[model samples]
Target: MSKRTIDYYTKIGILTPERSESNYRFYGEDSIETLHLVSQCKEQNMPLAEIKEKISLYYTSSVEKEKLLKYAQVLSKRMEHLEAELKEIKPLLDALNEEEQKSIINRMSPQSMALAQSLIILFN
Candidate 1:
């Protein structure tokens, strides 16, 4: 990793560096692993504040891997839930009888129709 990235993490208190007699910042093996983790979290687009908390937890206990895994699983479940809900909407729309569908279309004003179309585009 670049020196700038390491410096940033240190500045933000996510990683602490040891100081030599000359006052040069130095990192141990654990700090190296922490930097690797910070990189991984950034790749997944986690917020810096949240990454700091995760790393803090990693340092505090023996269940570091489990904590990270739980975060990943929660995110995975949310995506799955949203996908299922979106999929269900399609079948519900399809199941509406022709008359029901036409009635909804007929009742919708031009502005409402446009809004509905926009909403569909946004979600899809």
Candidate 2:
């Protein structure tokens, strides 16, 4: 972690550490546990304010299944949007020559191209 992040957490009171004789901050087990929780939340693209609120409310080292499921919904929504976008691109794809179409397909990731192909098949 960067010093800025630690300082931000400390400034926000999300993390509290004790000052030692040399004035170096020392964090206890609770702080360590909170750091782990914060890390997990950050990895899931959670905002710091929401994470702070969740930490304050739950005060746990583990994320609950409900919270995990809620996060997964973001991915579901994103996939739906991608499917719609791919659908719109379908008509434009028909205007391109075979080589141009292949070039466009090559530019896309395999998974994305597969999704486009599946949409084409489904609609046709």
Clashes of each: 0, 0
Cα displacement (angstroms), candidate 1, residue 44, comes to 1.0
Task: Show model 1 residue runs off by greater than 4 Å.
Answer: 62-124
Tens-digit lDDT track for model 1 on 39-93?
8888767789878877877788566777778777867774566566656777787
Alpha-carbon lDDT, every model: 0.80, 0.79
Model 2 misplaced regions, further than 4 Å:
1-61, 118-124
Give the CA lDDT, 0 to 100, for residue 87 in model 1: 68
Worst 10 residues of 2 by lDDT: 70-79
Local error of candidate 1 at 116, Å?
29
